[model samples]
Target chain A: MTAQPDHPDAKAGHTLISVDAMGGDEGPAAVVAGCALSAQANPDIGFILHGPQEQLDPLIAKHRELAGRCDVHHATEVVTMDDKPSQVVRTGKNTSMWSAIESVRSGEAAVAVSCGNTGALMAMSMIRLRKLPGVNRPAIAVLYPSSNPQGFNVMLDVGADVRADADDLLRFALMGTSYARNGMDLQRPRVGLLNVGTEEHKGRTELKEAYDLIRAQGESTGFDFVGFVEGGDISGNRADVIVTDGFTGNVAIKTGEGTASMIGNRLREAFKYSPLSRLASLLAYTSLRRLSKKIDPRRVNGGVFLGLNGTVVKSHGSADATGISAAIKLAAQLSENKFNDKLAARVAATLPAEESPS
Target chain B: MTAQPDHPDAKAGHTLISVDAMGGDEGPAAVVAGCALSAQANPDIGFILHGPQEQLDPLIAKHRELAGRCDVHHATEVVTMDDKPSQVVRTGKNTSMWSAIESVRSGEAAVAVSCGNTGALMAMSMIRLRKLPGVNRPAIAVLYPSSNPQGFNVMLDVGADVRADADDLLRFALMGTSYARNGMDLQRPRVGLLNVGTEEHKGRTELKEAYDLIRAQGESTGFDFVGFVEGGDISGNRADVIVTDGFTGNVAIKTGEGTASMIGNRLREAFKYSPLSRLASLLAYTSLRRLSKKIDPRRVNGGVFLGLNGTVVKSHGSADATGISAAIKLAAQLSENKFNDKLAARVAATLPAEESPS
Candidate 1:
């Protein structure tokens, strides 16, 4: 993999992932564990754990094997979960989340990873790092589990643009398509608008507008427009790429995550209910394991914030070392490929020269 | 359970159910199975299955043990999945779907259930049954599995009203509250509006508008308005009932369903990957069985269409006999309780008598 030539610091040929140690529910424990795990697994990946020195020191000391290799950018404050996204930049000026995001904006880090409040992280990324040219909105792209044996499906705009217009959705489709091609290595991704039904006129006013815009783009948009996709469509890989507004996307993603956990808990509950189910669980062992790998959260931990000037990955707030390790690996790949720049350039080429501004 | 004395059809005494035999992917089979299962369970629950006689005969015959128990009304034609809701009602006069709906309008059936094209069903229900006296728009209500071991969460308007206003949401809240009270048998159901955040001013325009309207009703409305809830709020059963527009609610429910299945499939895949997991699955047999039951679709097969004059349940089109059975059971319980009448009266009492109309 090679970074895009247009990337500001692509010629430096180095990968430094800034970790927001103050982010996530479990705080520094999970963040420290994840950073150490990533460092141990990938010798080439470097980390900058950003947080208050006093708070981060003990955790770093516990993982001395990674101490000599990792760097810490001491940040005094933290961004609380309840804080509004608009207030994140102002109130937590010295917070690790802000600094980590700034690190990427300044080319000090290849990517910034946070498990903090998604809205704050998104706000910081958009305001500080800024969006790539030709992209009106930067989307939170998620790789959802597909029923297909091939691989996962990618969708974007998962809560960044709540009141998204038709043009915004059109831009999201373009960005998602590029992300799939550049990030997931798909040649030409199939894109679809999330709707109540497949019919063009079946959606709400906003969705109807999006349907028309997407349809008007035609084959010239690069990605294959697969028409409208319903909620059930996500079960099967109906489209390689799906685009929806952030509110729906966020709800959908969280629902997916929560449902996964809920199902696991339910499965456990079922197995414990009676001796018959216990025996059934035993009989279904082989098939069950196969199913787990297909929908494992660890395997799908990293969520790329697309349409940004630089690549940024957000891991699950409740993620463990294994999940974090996967996130780092994903970030490393994004960095090496300079995925963001390629996506930006592709979007730019599609827009009129007079309308394109970089 | 006995019918409400105040209910208009209380004198009739009989619990009449209208089954759309032509609805569902498998047509009469699903509806017939549902009716048979429901009839066998509740001797007082009567069904009017509307469809072609030849097709309905075998389905009803399969449940011949309940021979004198059920009736099948012959409506020769059927509605195609792709047919527009407007087109179906305007042209398909003798269609099974329309005939089934007509049974409810004619006061022959206390309740109706369908698994056909959702749009067509909703359109027919609103047009024929009409919204309850004070209701402006009817909403689809669904039960979402919560992390709480006790019960699943109830969400209203999963896709019935696309352009719902503040007044429409208030009506949904009133309807949903009755569902929890009469249907789920909860006292003073905790109501909530699904939002991006818990803050009053945080959500989009429509949500904010709904929030203000719900707040204005306050405690006097006979509903315990529990304030705002996020997507994650559903997991913990933070509120007994949650309200949102049809578009978001539908996407949320479907997303949850797809995710639970995906995760279950993933776990199955994992167990088969190696001997260790296979052994683990066996040792964890009791846990696995419990989990299956926790996420079982049969347990939450039907979604009630709230704010209508009659109790109507819409099951998944692809639901099997067990799922259909559950839907039928839900329909019977709802009809016996006169859920809609209670909701409408409560809403009407809360609003000025003259201002109740849309």
Candidate 2:
């Protein structure tokens, strides 16, 4: 999987991001629209679009700005949302998702973005890009909208693997710290180990061991280890990065998202209950719009797969043009900053030599 | 610990609840006020208030309705919020929390209610009231407000213990099912095992094992086992009872609560942003109030400890009069239905004979 060294774009100064234009619920149109939006916002970004050329060409032609910067790579197959990870690894070689990731591996693109099934995307990324040196398990880190001055906090191992030993957790912390620094611009991110209680003696035995390991690496890694934190701190300003096992982090993130949506729906229903409240809703529309913008999940739609040789951003499966644009922007930003290289260096430096898999 | 044979109210038909009034953040005054409110609402309910007599007497005397129906039990010690569970279990015999639990053990009260440190209360309850036979761990079941017709769903193992194996999770499902049935008045509650994904092969190995165990006992336990459910279903009407390990349950519940509070605060701020919005808020005040009442955490304030020999309800430490009253009402409702005995019987009948701890 090596790019053609003689290719004209190989020496191009602009950053190239691989875009999987299929597999999402919104189809190829949204992906093309999102790429056009990103190209309009950032002139130095280029795309290696992977999908059936027949379907993607018409959509790309609609936007004048994207037509010049985007290059289509024809892929015959697509990975469905219900496909198993193991199945995808074996027979998904020709799919757009696989082709998109291949571009990164072959050095044709700096990062790859997919709005597809999370399990499938993660499995394919791991199999294709492989893990960084000394990393036993890769983690998926998401940007959580919080009350922090930065407006977002990084949380990792959201659903990469359901299990994490003490050593794995330490790896997650190092990776999460690097993401927080690069993504949120925190100089010395305060990392918190998520537990049921903040006390030293709460949670499973693995978490206790992880706490000590993380604290020991804090000085060396340049990130502050803040002992333990609880679920409330995920949305609060208590920590810039919250680390936990995949199971708990995944459940917590989804629960937070669901609860937010439920409350939002309830508020809308309350405002539209009567003619008077409906009139009031019109008056309060601007303020409500401001609040909506502040808490919109679409603004932070990408989940970065850390501990890999290449960077991969997994956007929501049902992402609209705005959500896809956010993911594309994140991918471009990470590619420009060489996030994957920095993350690998951070993991190698902080992870103990003894814990590295031989 | 035994009740006095000659007590005048021993033969009374009314259900008596033991309430620890000293340790909550709001102190005994709120507890007394809550008892008065409950007494006014339910004439057949009686309370045995456990705290310092001097402090509680004046407060109880002010509420004539409570003064007639409440009996004070003097206790000298209080369990601070920071006390360790192991330490409390070993040396917290004289605390009001301990005495309240003892009342339930001695049959002087049908159920015990405490608004104190959760760890200490759980420890004291286990030591005084003991775990039910065949139960390895007792779970704390909570009522989560949902879109169901019942207005709430049951979730269990929420911070009771940080670990749960396959057997333990099966026990949690049984206990949570009993809670939904007795507490929510469901004839046969639908039980769902919480997982990161809804697929059969997803999540940790123990959760997969639990799925099989719970499904096996569905017919005998008289509950519907709905297979695996994700975190989003926790607040929805898809399941009446959601069962999970303590760690995941604890994090999900807190995350939901935090997200709800954050959004609620944002909505309030949006309404008061400008004079037009403020006037809009005034016009929509009634609908907003109705929405607030529907989602208020105070309305579902009790966390019932299941898989135990006696019933114990834990109220939030910072609960005010309305929250305390809600806890008292839950205790009375459980006592009236003889929930503890029914739960024990259900556990014994559904649990395998060989899996019973010797």
Candidate 3:
């Protein structure tokens, strides 16, 4: 097993964060608040808010301490989260998001965090940083809000690519395994192919072929191959890592998030039913508040774009200050763990470097 | 709009529930407890537990009140949930699940409920009772454990057939709309097609074609077309009815359920960290208990196999008594609403009686 390298930021005494200041629903306010909070939390961290200085000047003034740590770069345009990734990337030059991507590529920052269009971030990251040597496809590795070390199931390719073949899936399994080991700090992560059923015969024909290939190369692969895992196992924490195509993974994650939100809303509504219950809601507010904090959407908002040459975290467009702050912290932590270095090394050593997508 | 019909169960003094006793993981115990609870809660609904009497007798004796409401129909074997639907129906003679399905076919019971293999239930139900006159395919409808009127999101197939054409999806939409009107008493329930995105260019070729068909027919068909809904909307209660093929729907639901279970487990772990939280956990146990009860899996375990000529509700194989009871209630409710009658009428009016598979 290869050891992960330390981050360049830790050695420099200045933690650099590349922020797409023009991203997300609230735009500059949310991003600046996040930058301020992160800089305050870790004095060592300095944020290069990649957007227009004129638009961000007011936000930087709110946090006096962060004023010194936060500097605004002039990238005039912004990418809407709803825009088509390929179309936007082709047309969007010198945009705040694209500039942020360049920061990571130029080694101006340890990590780039964006809350803009997921597709744009992915396309730009791949184009600028390129894929790790030998990785055919770069999967967007997600850490679901989980319990055990295995609780945080890693769902690959949530949105990077949709129409993947068997070879793409196998490559995802390889990338996903390294991600689980280096990012989550799990040894020999139990890798399971996400299927409708645990039975090998179950799932799409494409999945079946991928399963066979995994089985044929099963022993030689360093991952602790756990055969097929049913959908239920995703939340069960039985498998350390789960792999699936972006189409399915995106739907699965969205479904999970929508359900949790709906349930949370229902619970709130339930508590508001009567006067006595209303009072109970106030008295038990702290407990419920704490519970909600643990499951905060902002905290779990970032998705690590794994299998890339450098580290990048994607946040939700609707994220608020808390979410933005969490994204910054997450990017910092992922960079500090030397997640990309470890991932690149693993892909290079285990598979031919030239196989990676350009 | 079609007026909702009177519930069939309401006409009879004793509502007969045909139970596939041999079905499911816990088998007799699960069915017995479910039947007992159902009978205890709704005295009008009686049960005919169809299986080997020798196997069910002990479980029957455990609840005297349920014994008064229950009877035994001796079918020595069961159709395993793992068996292929076509093979099991052809080879498994006198299987309790098959017999239970037959009971509904012959009008021996008001409704039939099973926790056995879904494929077998779909096969037996389609072969015995048949599809609604103009319905090309039968859809499995479940209450999206997330919805406001607590209205159910009707997803067809749910795993009965893997590949679906445009016509199959359209059939699912029509059947699902009728089900919402009849089952949930919604007037012109909003129908949304489950796709990767809401845009015209968002889905695959088949889905794109289905989208066009839905737009063309929705105005004349009485269903309020809400346009395309992504997986994120499934649990947001965004639309009263959601339509998708058997494969994606099954994976989506399982993903939703798995996520809920995983998050619940994570909360429990997070609360274990502190002395204050542990003490609060004990005191807030009642509130948490109430919350858990409200979101109980047992309350919504059974999924309705829609578009069939008779009422057939499939419970998860791992269903506990709560899940079984939910299935029983759904079965009873469908019988009362005459769900099949309403769906059959709608299909005959809107679509052609015989259509080729897409």
Candidate 4:
């Protein structure tokens, strides 16, 4: 439930978000700190923190900002980063990840935020929340820093289901465009199906099929299908939304992040190479800091679970306080907008035309 | 046809690299200029330039350095970048791209360098040179700048074919390692299979099967298989070689390039933001140039066609003189090392195990 809606037209609801306090690589302390930061910023914001009471209670107590805003849900078990998804799903009923999602399922919380492993988190979320009707494969959508005026492009499935056929890809396109509109607020978003080439005849068979399917829905779905975008276009200004199977999307995003990180490190090394260069760096300090902040990974930290019955934001497992807070901000924004409700409607609206392969 | 060998023990072979002086976005002048630069640096380098006789003749004659080194091959037809690969392979025999590959097929040129489109070039290379025995899918391998001491990592199947099966992935692994050895001079390269996640249980089924197949061959193949690697690992120092199907590999490499390009633009923008920052940029010019040169896309300009009977280097279609020179440098180096002969042997050695999935 989102209490304070950013949009005047958004329906009023509670602003409390469910969060898994354990399972993050930085542990419960970072999560508590992030929650406190969120609580301090929005007086309406609250969190149902799930973890062992002993571990989370003291962490919350130290953060005075979280004094009355945190509700400790006693989940005695924890899902380790290395736990297998299948293993966790069967035996993880009492795990913090499961309990966090349970709050969303039981309608006690509007959204669930976790820094646990992606596979396990998805496994737990899907089982607890279930897929929206007519949704074949749920997808994980993440915002990528790009050349857009909005400063980022939406890409999915980062890793929900690795394989997506023609129909599934069409569904991804529908869901992704809806996300660009509701989440990023890009009205009439231009969507592109990711491929090796921009040519219609290139790529695999399913891609060609998906190309037609996506193009056919361009007018009716209320988004322009910028047919067949290449990998460079993922960050290029060609399209606002890039839709692909989970496997390719996941690799593209990671590769982009890696390149940015390496360049960032190299940028610092260049400034430190000589005394004059370091002195010049001091002069250019403000501009460089702005550039760094513009590209910082923490500023764009959440991966939204789409086509699900409830909203779940999977933060990076190694996220520190800043990254966790960024994720919480995204979760709250989506919850406040009733993003899941709209995403489900968008998918259901497109399903009647598709012959469900599943 | 034998020219000077960079390695004394390397088998002697002709260093005459065939050139397709047409179909590039920049046209024939750039191709002739690139050849002139290559000829200027290496007395052993000669070009069998292919294009319409009238168009290429004047361009070659204008370049004084190309006077004796350039041989213009007459071809009335050209392969436009927009021409479909399927159509080219059938009706493109007279096209400059096809004629260039023909030189390699006839052993008139030790290797061929093309500034033509990638899909057409790969199609021409595969059809003219043909896949090596026991190889089902031929791959394109490119050297990507990375955190390694060698300064680059080899990633394959960038876009040769859109799909690769488990066995084809194993071939890519073998071809990639062989590429690292001969192309980059890494004796025992650490290879990784790109996936959505590093976990063995993660990714599509084909990837899991590829993990085992590649791991099994690591001992005999002389490269360390570093299990499953994510998109970030493509640039990270976790491995020396990254292998995947053309679909994922293409997206990964393009995404990386796009990101690097975006950051490069942003870096320029950041420095130009204010008068002080611009003045600081002048003070730090040399250091910034070094960083720019380190990450410049032009320096690493060639994409090698692997799993073929003869070695082929596909130059970037938009390559200028400097970029073209880099592609020629790579082509000359591969020929000097007798890389194609070794690559053929490497694939031949692995086929006994694949059961000929083709």
Query: Which number leads on lDDT?
Result: 2
Worst 10 residues of 4 chain A by lDDT: A2-11
Clashing pairs for predicted structure model 3, backbone only: B7-B336, B81-B117, B158-B246, B298-B322, B298-B323
Report lDDT (Cα) of residue A97, candidate 1: 92
Q: How is the predicted docking of candidate 4 categorized under the CAPRI scheme?
A: high
Give candidate 2's TM-score.
Answer: 0.96
Tens-digit per-residue lDDT, B1-358, candidate 4: 2332232113243367888888888888888898889888887777788899998888877877876666677999989989888889999989988888998899877689998878888887887888787788999998888888888989998988888999999999998888898888899999999988887778788888888899999988799999998899888899999999998899999999999998888989999999999999998999999998998888899999988888889888889988888999899988888888898888887667454422
Best by TM-score: 2
* Reference-based TM-score of each model: 0.90, 0.96, 0.89, 0.94
Clashes of each: 39, 0, 5, 3
TM-score of 1: 0.90
Every candidate's lDDT: 0.76, 0.87, 0.77, 0.86
DockQ for every prediction shown: 0.44, 0.72, 0.40, 0.81
Once superposed on the true structure, which residue ranges of model 4 sit more than 4 Å away at CA?
A1-14, A353-358, B1-14, B353-358
Q: Write the per-residue lDDT of candidate 2 for residues A1-358, one digit (tens) a residue.
A: 1223234255457789899999999999999999989988987788889999998889988998775577788999999988999999999999999999999999889799999888999999998898888899899999988888888889989999999999999999999988888877799999999998999988889999999999999987798998898888888888999999899999999888877877777889998899999998899989999998888888899999998889999998999899999999999888888888898888777665455442
Which has the higher TM-score value, candidate number 1 or candidate number 3?
Answer: 1
Q: For candidate 3, what is the DockQ-based docking class? A: acceptable
In candidate 3, how many Å is residue B280 off?
5.9
The residue-level lDDT of candidate 3 at B329 comes to: 85
- Two-way TM-score contest, 2 vs 3, winner: 2
Q: For the second chain of model 1, what is the TM-score against the true structure's chain B?
A: 0.90
lDDT of 1 at A203: 76
Interface RMSD of 1: 4.4
